[model samples]
Target: MWPGGTVRDVAGLWDVALPAEAVRVPGVSMAGFRSRTDRFVDMQVVPYPALTLFVDFGDGRVVDDAGSRWMDSGVVGLAPGGARGRGRSIDCLQVRISPLVAHAVFGAGAEFSGAMVSLEELWGREAVRTRERMWEAGSWQERFAVAREMLLRGQSEGPAVDPEVAHAWRQMVRQQGRVRVAGLAEETGWSRKRLWSRFRSQVGLTPKRAAQLVRFDHAAHRLAAGEQSASVAATSGYVDQSHLHREVRAFTGVTPNAVAQAQWLDVDDVAWGRGRAGARRLRVG
Candidate 1:
């Protein structure tokens, strides 16, 4: 809502650390989004063997998967294979990946093309399903341990850079309150044009847009916890109330209050937030 658009009163997205060792994320959300009224926008229903990463791809209006680029707002997303009054809307663990991490694990040049293939291979279907099963079987601690071993401390590695972009980005999340494209380019010594090209080839969105998404996510996190608009805006780094509304509408497609009332998001929730999909083999010096 700040400089871009659609700020809400309160919004929230959830993340659960599944048992790392063996887990199978059931398609509980698919069942919940049965009616057309519950449909979300600009998302890809990327399914894994056990659990699925409900990534908020973008305003289905802008990103044209078929066209392979951004388009119009009238369009949004394709419906999943199933979703009736049976259960709940799709949800996910608010996870994210960085360009540096992918380059380090998959191989430097892999990021030039989509890095998702290698990630899918790294966290294979069987392993993914196993992780899900483990989650359903244990306490939160047990689930976290499994996830830590399997994901956090497993084969995952850092990105390839003198100064890790992933580390820098996490800082950006904390300090800048947004991942500014121009700033990243300046820090990396890449021209804005070069930066955008490389970023799109790898992460999907350009830098400024990605930063906005990250910012929106921060606000959504606060809102999800039942915070008020004024506090949410301040904590999330928004300038004020109007800014919040603008940002929320552009991203969440709902207001802060509405988002507070709602608990889950489907394909469009995080909108290309954390579902960029790239993990590399552990690389050492």
Candidate 2:
């Protein structure tokens, strides 16, 4: 047994640990990964519909193909395209927070539209301290506890989004991004222009773009699960199979078939639970 809890070790590639369900906070999910050997780590990171936070605890460094590097920890924003992580001996706690909750946890002014930022830029010295604390923890469960405490504190202290904005986002998730922005505006009792501007400022994506992203994420996962492009397109609010292909290409710079075979998505069932409604999980291969 591990110090705090038993970790599910998978084929010795990496050790994956999850928090107890009782301790799981709403709107937040996290998984801990520790490399079992010194092999080189290289993998594609598929975009998901949540704000991603990485808390690093290993000696190795992870850098993307685009020249951006995170030696310690960092945050990845919405729709960060074509970024692949390359490293060795990787160890980190990966947290996925819903944009609705993230807006409050990171504050309204935080930029996450389509960028990767060092944790220091947003959390300053606190980021370093948090990393140190997690590294010092006895086990993955302890580390998850520390991270959960931090998120709870941040969410409690941060500014909240408008209730209408939260409602719209929930609706999008509930409907798998098939809802209309104009309909959301009417439901929220706000004008289209007002809702559009507010959502952009608060969530870092326009309502329409956010809907598209949600739709894309759902479709991508479906493809990853071996569903045909035509079927996914038909059910995921796309105009046609061609539309699905184009969207997969636009968001990931790859075809739907390529996305289906992406290694990054291989762990979703274990980490996020398969077919759980509204589970926003991040995938870094």
Please provide TM-scores, in order, for all candidate models, with all chains considered together. Answer: 0.46, 0.91
Runs with alpha carbons beyond 4 Å of true place in candidate 2: 59-65, 108-110, 275-285
* Backbone N/Cα/C clashes per model: 52, 0
lDDT of 2 by residue, 1-285 (tens): 145654766555667788876557799988877777776666667888898888766654545547656545787788878766655666778899898888877763336676777878888999889888887888778888888888899989988889999999999989989999999999999999999988988888899988889999899889877789999999899999999998888888989998887767766766776432322233333
Compose the digit string of candidate 1's lDDT tens values, residues 37-137: 23442232221111222222122222323334432111111111111111123222222234343343333332333212322344567455644654363
Candidate of highest lDDT? 2
Local distance difference test values of all predictions, in order: 0.39, 0.78
RMSD of each: 14.0, 3.5
Model 1 score (lDDT): 0.39
**Against the correct fold, how does model 2 do in TM-score?**
0.91
Error of 2 at 86 (Å): 2.2
